[model samples]
Target: MTTPANRWRDTPDRYGLISRLLHWLTAAQVILLFGVLLAWKGFGEHPVTLLLARIGPHGSLGAMLLVTTLLRAIWAYRQRHHRPPRPPGVGGLLARSVHLAFYTLLILIPALAILRQYGRGGHLIFYGMELLPEAEREIAWMMAPADLLHSPLAWLLLALIAGHVAMALAHRLWLKDGILARMLGSPQATRDT
Candidate 1:
């Protein structure tokens, strides 16, 4: 039987509890952030949009996501050797590339926002507590990357997320290869990989 401690660490076949928790939590946050943005764009000044806004302010959610993504990335690196092996050939390469892209955007999107915030001499507030103090003056250079790339990169990240979800569903429903199960199922679950 797997011990309680063992359940918290990755094995060669499946992700551990911490990894799964982080993955799902991050997914939830992303969904909420995007959903709110979409609702605001679609509904204008509707009550539902206001409610969603109250639930998750973009800046606060972005800050939280930045911290979560950093932690998840660190944990993934530590668990890399213990996690399940990837498929061979181009399949593995594609998988790695997509994942790397996800991490890149996940880290960069909020980082750029924070950089822009700092450049504007604004405090970085998360859940009402200030993390970064206001600056003395706006630094145009520091804000330029975000000003130019933030919206476009955010749209790209959303597209990537959609593709990621579709692939996971394909694995679960069509392929029946247990790739999705490796992340969603219990550690004891048997996976082909």
Candidate 2:
């Protein structure tokens, strides 16, 4: 049986509760953010899209995502030595590179957005809380990086996420590997793998 302590911390065979929680939470936020964007693009100014926009404004969702990603990164670093091992050889190298990129983009995307928002001299409201008051003048340099790269980088991040999901599914269905189980299954299920 999985002990209480083991459930909250990473093991060599499976992810701990905290890790799983953060992972899934982050995934949910990403999906919601993307869904809103896609809906806006596809449906234009439909009532449903307008409602979604109000409920989950782009800035608010991005702020939440940024916080979650940062927390996940910190937890992952702490659990680095205890988490499940990566695949051997070339697969491991590729996995490592992809993960590094994932972390980089996850942090960068929202960070750039926040920077841009501030540069525009607009008040920053996160979940009804005012985080930044409006400035007297816009800072062009502060906004430049995000204005130039935000959309392009966002598209690239989407592509990376797609590849990540495909690989996970491939591992579970085609390779019959326990990789998916490591994160999705109970500790007992992964211990034997």
Candidate 3:
């Protein structure tokens, strides 16, 4: 009874609508964030980055991503026992490790950024609304982890995602498995077992 309209919950055989939405939505946001960063680095204050800055700053995007990431994590926990079975082997272990890393970085990067923002006496503002008020003075200790890890960790996350996509492609093309289809296609399109 997993019709397209009613696939909001996950099944043991495939992902449901909510998971797919969160997955793709988060992917899009991360891609945009990377694009903005790349543009900022290559063309420091180019019109495109300036225009995007006007619409929403990178901080706001990170906050939004954090929210989505939390929701995804919660959903994943609730569905932990309901997800598809992994193929038992080293590949499975690697997949699980990558997923754990993804979840960790998704939560950690923004968290570190928020901490750094606070330590620097800057408010954590989202869409121009203040979430965390600025501290009266800079706290070097609060800001150190972000200073050392944020950029590097973000790049590592991007690399992991690239590998994740490559594996999914491998599942679709080389393995002839329906792993990718579970996220991208209807129930009928995926292999049930």
> How do the residues 1-193 of candidate 1 rate in per-residue lDDT, one tens digit apiece?
5678878988876788999999999999999999899999999989998999889989999888989999999999999888878878998899999999999999999999999999999998887898999999999998999999999999999999889899888877887787888787444356434
Which 10-residue span in candidate 1 carries the lowest summed lDDT? 184-193
lDDT of 2 at 45: 98
Q: Give the winner by TM-score.
A: 2
Ranking by TM-score: 2, 1, 3
Runs in model 3 deviating more than 4 A are 3-6, 188-193
lDDT of model 2 at position 63? 92
Residue runs of model 1 more than 4 Å from their true location after superposition:
187-193
In model 2, where do residues sit more than 4 Å from their true spots?
188-193
How close is each model in CA RMSD to the real structure? 1.9, 1.8, 2.1
What is the lDDT of every predicted structure here? 0.89, 0.88, 0.86
Residue 164 in model 3: lDDT: 96
Give the CA lDDT, 0 to 100, for residue 121 in model 2. 94
The C-alpha local distance difference test score for the whole of candidate 3 amounts to 0.86
Better of 2 and 3 by TM-score: 2
Please identify which of the two predictions, 2 or 3, would achieve the higher lDDT against the true structure: 2
